[model samples]
Target chain A: MNDVIICRCEGVRLSEIEQAIREGASAVPGVKKRTRAGMGPCQGRVCQRVVLQLLQQPPSEAGESPDALQRSRSPVRPTLLGDL
Target chain B: MNDACDVAVVGAGPAGLVAAIEAARAGLSVTVVDEFPWPGGRLLGQLYTDPRSHGRWDGRKISRQLAQEAGELGVRILGGATVWAVGRDLSLELSGVPVGTLRPQALLLATGAAERALPVPGWTKPGVVCVGAAQTFTNVHHVAIGRRVLVAGIDPLALSVAMEMHHAGVDVAGVVLPPVSTTSGALASPERAVARLADVADLAPNGLLRAAARLAAGKLSPLAVSALRFDLVRVGGVSIGFRTALVAVEGDGRVESATLRSVAPDGTLVGPERRIEVDAVCISAGLYPLTDLAEIAGCPMVEVEELGGLVPLHGPGLETPLERLFVAGNLTGIEGAKVAIAQGRQAGCSIARSLGRATLVSPEDAARAVSDARTSSPFRFQPRIAAGRAAMAELWQQAIARGDQSA
Candidate 1:
C-alpha cells in the first residue's frame, strides 16, 4: 500500500501522502503543495477524492472536509498555449 | 457549427440529449457538446432488466434512440467537444470542435457522474481498469479485458458488470470485496456488502434467485443474507466472495495474478494471503457526480450524502442559482438514466419558460415526470435519492431567499 501510486499523473505514492499528512498537511492543497499530488495535468480529477478520504481517516486533520478542494482554474482540459 | 445558439448543453448523455430534444422541439436552436467521440455518455454499455416491466433496459439501444430523436429535432450534437471553462459572463470555452467559444441564451449542464477509484496494491498495472470501463469495453466496444479476470468491489455496478462480462464470454474468476481501509468502511464488511446486494437482488441473473429476490422486494432481512451467503451466490457462473478481499493485483507488465485475503465478518483481516491466477482486475469503488463544470459555472454546490456527493444546488424545476443556467442528470445527483432523462425534460421546459417561450410540456408536468421516473427505476445507486433531492430543494429555497438566484 505504501508503494501504491495515488496520483498517476505525478507518480505520487501513498507513502508520500501519509508523510504529508504527518507533517501538518491536513487538506488536499497542503498535500499538493508538499507532495504535488494534484498539480498534474488531469488537475486532481482522479486523485483528489482519494486524498479527501485519506483526510477523513482516523487521526483526521481535515476537521470539516476542507471546503471542496479549490475550484479548478481555467483550461480544465489540456489546451495548447498557441490556442490562446 | 454556429458560434452561438439558443441553448448549449455541456453533455450529450441521456439528460443532455433529452434536454436538447425538448428545447429544440420548442423551436430553440440547441447544441449539445460531449467529450467522448460519440453522443451517448455512460448510457452506452448499460444492460439490465427492469423488474417492474420484466423487459430489458438496453443502454446502447436507448442511447441511439435518444440521439436519433435529438437529430430529428434539429439539435446539433458535437461529439469530442470538451467545454474547458465557463467564463463569468457564461461564455463557454470549448475545444475539439470547429468553434472555439460558444455564447448561448441558456446553458444546461448535464455533465454525468464519474466512477470513484479504489486504489489497491499493484492497481496501476496495465490490465487493471475501473468496472465501468470494463463494462464499456465488453458491451460497447466488443473488447475483452482478459480471458480470466478477477473483480474487486461488491457493488451494484460491479455485480452487474461481472454478469455482463460473463455474458460476453469472459471467464469472470470471482467478484470479491476491496480491502477494508479508512475509506472503504462498510464495503469491506461481509454483512454490509451482503445487505447492499440484497437491495439489487431483483437484478440477479439467476432465474431462481431473481424470483426469490423479487419476492423479498429490496428488504434487508437477515434470512436474505444467510440464505445466499456471498460465497454461495453465483451470478451467472461468476462467484461472489463477500468475505474475501482483493489486496493486490501483481504482474510483470500486465495483470498475471491477484492476491486475496480472508476478511472476518467484524471487518478485520484474518488468515493468510491467498493468490489467485487472473489476467485482469476490475475495481468498482462507487460513483460520485461529476461537478467540475457546475463549479466552473459558479453554481453553488451542497454535499448531500444521499445524492452521492457534491452537486449543484437547484430547485425542483432544475433551475440553478445562476440565472438562465440550469443543471440536470447526474450533475444534479446520481440516479438512473431514466431519472436523468426526466430531469433533462424538466430543465428544458424550465429553460424555455425562463426565456419566456412556450414549452410543449409545462415545467410542473416535467418535474412530476422526474419524480415518477425516480420512484419507478429498479436500480437504486443511492437509496436515499429522494431525501437528497428534497434537501437540495430546501437549500435552493434558502439560496433564493438570500437573493442568490439573480446571478
Candidate 2:
C-alpha cells in the first residue's frame, strides 16, 4: 500500500483519510471537517475523484453498486476575499 | 440611512469593482454591496502559490486599492452585507431578511460564478473535497489540508491548486480526468499547457522532482492502501488506483463509505465490501454562472450552449431587457477576470451615458474598447466547459436517484 494524496489543497492523503475512517469519521463531511481536505482554494475540484475511489464499498457487501452522493453545498472557486 | 445612488452594483469582484469605480468616476452616486467583510470577491484571499516559485500575494490588496479609488470618487461601498434576492424593481434582500430597498437609477449584476458539482461513486466520502474549498482554506486561513492530495480535472484552477499544494509542502499525487480532455480552447491549449508544464519543471526543478517522485512511487502508504483496498496501477511514475468495483455511494448526508460492485476496465464484482479510508477529497468538475440574481432581476437571459447555462443576451450596450439593469462579468459567461473587468467598465459607461453624463469616451467608444479587451482574454474553453457540465448533470442525476432509492 502506498500513500495516496486525494485532496491537494488540504494535503489529505488516502492513508490519512482511511486512518480517519478507522478513527471513526463515518461520513464525508465529518472527515472533511476533521482533516480539512475539501476546504481549500479550488474548493474540492482536485481530490474528489480520489475520494470516491477510496471510499468505494461499505463493510458488508462488495458487489453493491456505489450510490451517487451529493454535496450539501456546492463549492465555488475562491475569489478575492475582499471582492466577495 | 436612506440614500439614493445613480447606480447600485451587486458583488464586488472585478465586475462590481470596476463598475462602481467607472460609474463613480463618471459622477454617478454608485453604491456597491458585497457579502464579505472587504472587497475583491473570490480574487481576494484566494491562494495561488506560483507553481514555478511558491510566491504568494494578498488578492485583497488589489481590490482594496480599487475600493480606495472608488471611495475617493464618493462611491458608497457596503461590505459584510449579503444581497440574498434581487427583484425586478431592483430591491435586494439582505441575508434572507428584508432590508430597505434601493431603487437606483441603474443596476449592474456582477454576481460572478459558482462551481458545478459532479457526482461520482463515493463522491460523498469524508475526504472528498472541491478545488475552490482547498484554495480558500490555504489562502484565507493559512491552513494546510493534508500531507498528500490528489487533484482531479485539468482546468487552470485545478492545476493551480496542485502547484500550490506542492509549493505549500503538500505532496500532490497527480491530476485525474474522465478519460477525455475537456479543456480544448483558449483556457489553455493542450500543447501550450504541456509546454508550460515543461517550463514550470525547468523553473522549479524541486517541484518537478517531487512530482516525478510522487508519480514514480506507485500506490499510497500501506495503511491507506490496506484500508481503502483500491486497485492501483502505475502510470508515468504515478500510482493511479481505479475503483472498478463501485456499486453505490452511501453516506448519512456526509460521505462515510461507498459500496463497490466491481472494478472498472472489466466489470466484475469484488466479493465482500471494503472501505478505503481518506481524509478529504477535492472535486473540480467545472464552473457555472451565478445567474440567480440576474434572473430575479428580469434580465433577458438565453441559454448559450457553448457557455454553459443561462447567459444574458446583451447587445453592444450590455443592457438587459430591463432598461436600467445591466449585466456583466461571469454572470453572463465564465470569461476570465480581465474580460469581466472590461465588461463591467463598459456597462458602467453605458449606464452613465444613459443618465446623460457627458464624458470624454462615448458609450460606443467604451463598447469598442470592451470588445477589444474581450478579444484578448484566454477563456475560450467552451467544449471542456460543456463536457464538465454534462458530467455534473450525470452526477446530480445519479445522486437524486440514489437518494430516492435510499428514501
Candidate 3:
C-alpha cells in the first residue's frame, strides 16, 4: 500500500510517472515515452486508465482532456496478424 | 444466412441467444455474431448449485436450448465473428483481413458485461486473473487455473468461484474482502457492506434457517454461526481472511504470492500484514456492461455505478436513442442472467415489432414474455437492482431534459 505500483507489467511506479511529468513530459504519449508505462504486454489495457487519472493534475493539463488523449490511439485491442 | 439479415445480434450470450430466438421465431432472418468459438458466453463457465434450492443448475442446458431454438428458426450463428466496429448506418466492420460486410435491418447488442479490472498493485502479473477468467479456464477449457488460489472478494462471484474451484480440487486458500482503507473501499459503506454480507447468507439460507429453528430461546445458533462464516459460506469449505485487503502481488516471473493487509471500517490499518503464498489470485470487484459497440453506434450513455459503470440510455424495451439499435442483457445493466434473458426476449419482440413486415411476435406477447421470465427466480438482489435502474433512468431523463432546455 505504501509503494503503489501502477504499471504492473513493467513495474512502473507512480513516483516514476510523477518524475516523468517533472521532467517535461506534457501528455500521455510524452509520459509513456519517458516512463514506458503503457508499452507492456497488456498494451495499456490496465495502465491507460491509471495514466489518464495521473495526467489529470497540474503541468500535464495543458492540452486536450485526458479522455480525448486516451481515445486518440487506434487499434484498441491486440490486433491479430489476420486483422491486418 | 446471407450478408443481409433482418436482425443482427452481437455477442451470443444468454441475452443475444434469447433475442435471436424471439426475432427468428417471429419470422425475422437473424444473424448472431459472437467472438467466442462457441455460444453460452459466461454462462458456460458458471457451474454451481443454486444456493436457494441446492440444485445444480446446468447452464449449458438452457444455453443449448436457446441455441437450438435459434437454429431451428433459421438463425445464422457466426460463433467466431469479431466485430471490429459497428456504425450507425447499420453496417459492421468485420475482423481479420477485411471480411464481408453485414447490413441488418436492426442490431441487438447483447454484448454483456466485462469483468471490471480491480487494479491493485501487481495485478498485471501472469497468474493474477479475474474470477470470470478463472471460471472459464476450469469449466470451459477443463483446465485448472492453479493448484493453489487466493480469492480477493466475498461477493457472489467470489464465493461461487471459490466453491467451484474447491469442488474442482483446486486448493482455495481463502476468500477475503478488500481492505476498507483502500481507495476502492465502497465495501466500507454500511449499506453496501450489509447488502454484500446479507447476500452471502441469502445465498445459502437453508442452512441458516434450519440452524435458526434449532436455536434455544432465540440464542445464536452455532450451526448457523459456523455456516455463515466466510470460510463456510456457499460450501466453499476454505479459509476466509476478514478485513483483509490485497496490497500487492509478489512473484519471481509468474504470480507467487499476494500481500493482504487488514484494515478497519474507517479506512485504518488495524492488524499485521499477512502474505499468502499462492500461484493464482482471483480478484473481483464487479462486472461492468461493455458499451463500446453501443458507443460506436452513437447511443447516448450515462454513468451508472450500480450497473458497474457507463451504460447506454434506453427505453423499457431496450431501444437506444439511436432507433433500430437495441441493447439487452448486461449491456444495458449488470443485473443477472435471468433479467438478461427477459430483456433479450423483450428486445427481440421489440425489434420484430419495429423491423419485421409480417411478424408473429407482438408487443403484448413480448411484454408477457418478459414478465413471465422476470419473476420466476426468487432472486433477492432484484430490489436493489430495480432501485439502481430507477435512479439511473431518472438521471438519464434529467440529462435529456436539460439538453432540451439548453437547445
Candidate 4:
C-alpha cells in the first residue's frame, strides 16, 4: 500500500493500480481510467512522468532497461475540447 | 478519410499536453490539436511570458520545451486551428474548414477555462480589461495597459497580474475582493496545500502601495488622464480605486462594460447608483466550467456548488456515463495546471491499459501521482461563485427584459 496518491484530484492510490494490474489490467491507460488515478484537477501533468517511468520498468526487475516499456506520446498537456 | 491517431487530445494546455505525450509514449498514434498557433494554451499566452517574479517556474521556457518534446515524440501537432464543433461521429470541424473525421479510440477534453465577467457601470469603458487580457498583453504581446492600473478580484491570478504589471513598470491600484471570505463557506476544507498557503495580508498592502507609488512616480509612458477623480478604497486586504478615463474595453467581439449600483458587503448595492470611473478595470471575478462539448456528447455533468458549475461526473479512469469516452483536466473541476497534467497522464495510462496495449502502473506510482496532484491545486469551493452566478444571471435577465421593453 503505497502512501503516495499520484493523482490527487481523483484520489487515486498507487496501490490501487498495482491491485488492478494484479487483477488483469495490462496497460497504463486502462489502469488509469479504471482506477481514476490521474483524472484529477492537474490532469496528469505531474503524474505523467511517474507513470511513464512505471510503464518503462520491467515487471520483474528493480530498474530494468527501457526496452520493456512502451513509447510515450506528445503534447503532454490539456488542450481545449473545442480546439481539438 | 481523415488522418487518425490512437488518441486525439484537444486544447494543448496542461491536460492535453500530458495526454498526448503519454499516449504517444505508449505507442499509440496521437494527434494534439490547438486553436492557438502554438502550444501551452493559456500558459503559452500568459504564465510563460510573465511568470511569477518570485516563483521558480518559467512559464514560457517550459511551454517551449514541452512543445519541442511533443514534436520529438512524433506527435502531430496542429496549431492555429479552431475546433468549432465535435460531431456525434467523433469528427471535428477545425476553424471553418472541414477536416477529415477521426475515430480516435479515446478522446481527452482539456479545454481549460474561460474568464467570468461581472456587470457594472462603466465596465464597458475602454480602460476596463479582463485580468487575463491584461496578462496576455503584458506577457505575450509585450504591451502594457497604462502607467497606472487598477486590478480587481482576489483570485491568485489577479495577484499575478498585479505582479506582472509591477514588472512591466505599470502601477497597480489594488486588488478588490468581495466581502465574502473563502469561496466555499466553512464546510469546504482546503483541497490542496497550495489553497492553504495564501497569505492575504501579504498580497493586499504590497499590491496596493506598489501600484499607487508606481503611478505617483510616473513610471509609465505618457498616457492621457482625463479629469477623473481616482478613489482608492481598501476593503479587508483588498484595495480598489477608480481612474479617470473614458476608455472602453472592446475586442474579440464583446462589449465589456455595464452600470450597476455599488454593492455592500452583504451583496446589496449601495446608494441608488454611483458611476465608478476607471481607466482600465480588470476583472479577476473567477471562472466557470466549460462543459459545452461534454454536455453535447451526453457526458453526465453535476453542478458541484463547491467546484464552480457543471463539472462532469466521472469515476476512476476519467470515465463518464458514456462508455469509451474519457474526460481529463479542468473539465472535471477548476484546480490548476499541475493537477490537469496529472489527470491527463492517468487518463492516458488508464486508456492504454484498457486497450490491452500497456501494463498498468503500480499502486505506488498511482498514489504518488494523486498526492502530488492534490498538493499542487489551490482552489476551494466558494459559495460566492454561486452567488456571482446568480447575480449575473439576474443581471442578464434584466438586460434582456429591458431590451424587450425597448423593442
CAPRI-style quality class for the chain A–B interface of candidate 2: incorrect
The residue-by-residue lDDT of candidate 4 on B187-225, one tens digit each, is: 111111112213222222234433433343342211312
Error of 2 at B62 (Å): 2.0
Tens-place lDDT digits, model 3, residues B1-407: 22788899988999999889888877889989888878888778755556556786677777888898889989988887777667668777666323456889999989887765566666767898888888888778877788899988756566667777887899988877653433354643322433454543434323322221223112223223322223222232666554456777889888999887764443355567779889998887666677667777777666555555567777666777676988898887776677778788889888887874545666677666655554444333333565557765676566557662111
Model 2, span B165-251: residue lDDT tens: 666776666554322111111222222223223322322223332342333232332123233344444433443333322233345
Better of 2 and 3 by TM-score: 3
Label model 1 with its docking quality class: acceptable
Estimate, for each residue in A44-68, the C-alpha lDDT of model 2 and write its tens digit: 5444433543454422231122222
- Candidate 1 vs candidate 3, DockQ winner: 1
Model 3 alpha-carbon drift over 4 Å, by segment: A1-12, A16-76, A80-84, B51-55, B96-99, B179-183, B188-194, B203-236, B357-383, B395-407
- Per residue, candidate 4 scores C-alpha lDDT tens digits across A1-84 of 153454555766556766766776565576676786556544444343345334533333311222222222222234445434
What does candidate 1's lDDT look like per residue over B1-407, in tens digits?
43888999999999999999999888899989999998889889887777788798888899999999999999999998888889776778888788888899999999888888777888888999999899889988999999999988876778778878888899999988886766566668766776666666755533433533443344334345444433435544777776788888889998999999878766678789989999999998888888888888888777777887778888878888888999999888888888998988988898888878899897678878888997787767886787888888777777779888885
Regions more than 4 Å wrong, model 2: A1-84, B45-58, B96-99, B178-277, B378-407
Highest lDDT against the true fold, candidate: 1
Q: Is candidate 1 or candidate 2 better by DockQ?
A: 1
TM-score of each: 0.93, 0.60, 0.80, 0.60
What is model 2's DockQ versus the real complex? 0.04
